[model samples]
Target: MSNRSRANRPTPDLSDANNPHAQKAQNFGPSAKRLFGILGQDKNTLIVVFIFSVLSVGLTVLGPWLLGKATNVVFEGFLSKQFPEGTTKDLVIAQLQAQGDTNQASMLENMNLVPGSGIDFDRLASILLLVLGAYLLGSIFSLIQARILNRIVQDAMNRLRIQVEEKIHRLPLSYFDSIKRGDLLSRVTNDVDNIGQSLQQTLSQAITSLLTVIGVLVMMFIISPLLALVALVSIPITIAITVVVAKRSQKLFTDQWKQTGVLNARVEETYSGHAVVKVFGHQKDVQEAFDEENDSVYKASFGAQFVSGIIMPSMMFVGNLSYVAIAVVGGLQVASGSLSIGAVQSFIQYSRQFTQPLSQLGSMANLLQSGVASAERVFELLDEKEQDPDPLTPATVAHSANRLEFKDVSFGYTEDNTLISNLNLEVRSGSTIAIVGPTGAGKTTLVNLIMRFYDINEGSLTLGNTADSAIDVRTMTRADLRSRTGMVLQDTWLFAGTIRENILYGRPDATEEDMVAAARAAYVDRFVHALPDGYDTVLDDEAVNLSVGERQLITIARAFLANPRLLILDEATSSVDTRTELLIQRAMSKLRQDRTAFVIAHRLSTIRDANLILMMEHGEIVEHGNHRELMEKQGAYWTLYNSQFQAPAQHESQTDGDHI
Candidate 1:
């Protein structure tokens, strides 16, 4: 097929009703207004931007008017010579004189001598110079405006990103638990970036376009009211088309950005788990999911771009039609001696100028709407409920005594389905308390409450020197409550940093000697010396460079360095082999020596020597005793112990997905 033939073929249907990006619809106006409010915070810079923009636009608006004067000077002489039917040079001169313009009439008569191409070089040069000067000033002002706006936009975006970063810490862990990491990442990075770029491009341009539209219309009316009215014919039509098309494209633009975020999420998740996908032979499934997301993004972007692309051409068509009508009417008025030839030329130029800003504004509206959508997403994140408020006079623990008491504590992820209810416990300072249970028991939930990760739904959890004299945990701030606590979880987390750095994170001000002592205590130094860089070895993404045991050792070292009054170790050695498990057990023995600790373990062997053991089932402790006492009872604890030794493999397989 020829190029023309292919071009003539209709565009494909790019809209998708079933698209994931089409989940929600929003209004851009309020978001846009809110965005403006945010910008208004930097009122000084905004005022300066507004001043430069006005100066730039005001200077540009004078170009056509001045050039029109020069054109009128040249044509006044020539038109007088080409007198039509009843309209003569004498008649025009008489009319000018009659209007008390003797000085202009005298100038026209003098310039008529070289009437064939009667362009007064002196006067034309003067007008051209003035036009050039105006244009130059306009350009300078525009450059200044752009630079200021870019600075303002970058500053605003920086503040926005910082706000999001700070908000993360203030938000409840439950919010993060429910939301995806990739989505939050997109909000902090991609969404904020979209707003920055769009604002940088649109702020000055939108203002200039609006100002130009108004300025051009005013000039047009001054030039010829009759021709201005003709140009006005398409104003409502152009606006109507822009408004209707823009409203439809607003949703499409929002979908496009939303798909962009979704696409980012898919890429982030896929790449992060690429090895798992390949190992499990699930590459095809992953690819299929990615393809579906990619296609949705394409369709949404195409629909948005195609619809927004309509505005420019539609406005151009209306503008051109208006131009033609103005030209015809101006010519008639000129022929009837009601308007000057130069005035007609200026009116036509102004008409083009008028439509130019309208078209520009139409295009800018699309970008503004998209920016607002991103702003709304960002604003939504900012509006999430923060962690409970801090107390006016927060409770404090005496350095010597940090006893914890749970009196009728109860909580659940939701209120209707309570996971732990009517629970009570008392823990002495500097003692190890083992919480043991079958799979699905609330052992871990109990620890989470102790750390204040979740507040109790009922009753009072207090901390003090003695159980009876304890102050409610709620009276103390979360930061203060968690500060003296140390935790090591089943899954070890190490960031992309040196072994020393990860350890130092637990106690940033710890001395080098203290760090080495903690590492030695946790047996981390045993393996660290074998690595090429010793303690300075940098971990890769997710710390995959280290073995599971090595990573667990690093975490134990972290806890040891913290040396907190309270320690919570949850399945710290559950997944390691026999040798590594023994190494971790030794470290645990050292760390738990004389420290107030809550140990949650699946392997009953690790907790056999715990000072006190509470065997939990469902949400309550079914049996409580020392290891020997529980073993003698031949109850839940005895059955779980016998089962672990009887079928170790079966026990692990059955409890693999257990919450506790």
Candidate 2:
């Protein structure tokens, strides 16, 4: 599939959805919106699980009602003689008949509570069994719903993690240059992890707590609306307190995450560059830097947690006050013969059920806020633009002997500083072209443009003969373009894998014979065979086990294996010893055969056989010609060659031509 198609596919926007700062208020409307969105993603599972949750909530209410009924049954048996001496039995029968207005009462009466009555003990045992069964069924439903919700959250997090990773891969390289590696890492790792945790712990619990509150309020109103109204007065007060605390906590959590990123960056830098620190005897300096960052992280985290911590206790205080108010009012009503003891008991239970979830929800507000902070960072990354759009409908390329051409190309990373302007060049197929210049002459930038790592700001680059037939690099797929190009750089990077794997990285489907041939050509086979495991030896981190020269050889071998139509060797032999440089030069000679090659080298001797040499200065070509033609001109090329290359040779000759 095309890279564009792969990138455009719909994925979870975890960052946007989870951002704490983005959520304005903790109202039921917004919470329900988020909840429904999550559920809508997998409606089938949500529907089934929601049904089970409702059944569980309904059954939970039945347990309290059943207990109340059983309590009344016990009280009636004791009060039977208080009704009237002779009419006691009649009164008892009348009470039972009145209570048997519901199906549950009928079920209860079948067990028989009348004194001296032939009550069936077996039936009573069965009624007790039914009560136990109801409780167990409710517990089972709760467990099932909890598990399903947890799975939904986990799956959503998984999808979000994958989306962030894909965005990172597709984002422009320039974006990374402007952003800290540690900060990006924190967003993907730390932020996403927080979201997952919040979903698992806070999200499911919040839902259950909300349902509990609603169910309890309904029950409370049924028993006594006057008492319920008194209890509910504390809600607005509690919410006001929660809102103020949540606002402060959100800011603190955001600051905490920012500080965490800074700390992570400092730690990563210190560890990664430990060798440099020790070599420079800067251990104390590094330690102080680390301590500063660590202190920042600690302070920010402590303040955020401390501020958020106040919410739970505050909620409890409000809840306790509300509870006392309900009790005082309820007791007065019962004393005045306006309420029953059973109704009072049920109302108190419902009040506790109502306030308990609200308190728990308050406690989890901080975690939810932290998750939001994380989401903001993740979304920022996802929203970044990709390097350049690949062609929606690309033009086909037919085989041709056409040369690569740069026509009045001007480029810059940013608008204020132009690297190269009105630059023009031509590189024929199967020709060796050398680009020689002083430092910062845009040599590497030119190479980057050729590979389409960055597009030029102005002008055009053509790959064919006719300007009308020229193909834009952006119009071609990156994978296809990269497959046709090969590069070997000064700082060779070998991934942590076997030597065989590193060499075959460019062409995973290559035959073993092809790999061996490429390795032999790149002169990498000599070192490989000398190792204990030959090509099977695994490389360590950064390939520190291999010498710099050996790493260069491996990279060269990779290029050879790919066998691209175009080759770029950017100071490939600069860091090696004389003998190794010779080996690399020999490998380059073979690799450059029948391919268009661009060589960027500091050493002038390496490019003496180039078909054409372009001498550059200040991001512009000053002179261009072959070795003899440049020497004959006695111009900029001659001046550079005599000073930089010839003077070194003359000095060496005076020292008996030492091989360097």
lDDT of 2 by residue, 566-616 (tens): 898888887678987887787788788878889888788889999989887
Instruction: Judging by lDDT against the true structure, name the best candidate.
Output: 1
- Candidate 1 contains a number of clashing pairs equal to 0
The list of candidate 1 runs beyond 4 A from truth reads 1-26, 76-118, 648-660
- RMSD list, candidates in order: 9.2, 7.3
What is candidate 1's lDDT per residue for 154-248, written digit by digit as tens? 88888888888999888876676555566667778888888888898888888888888888888888877777788888889988998899898
User: Global CA lDDT of candidate 2, please?
Assistant: 0.75
Model 1, residue 416: distance off in Å is 1.7
- Supply candidate 2's per-residue lDDT for 551: 90
**Number of clashing pairs per prediction, in order:** 0, 2
The candidate that wins on TM-score is 1
Worst 10 residues of 1 by lDDT: 1-10
User: Candidate 1, residue 47: CA error in Å?
Assistant: 1.5
Candidate 1 structure, TM-score to reference: 0.88
- Report the Cα lDDT for residue 105, model 2: 36
User: Lowest summed-lDDT stretch of 10 residues in model 2?
Assistant: 1-10
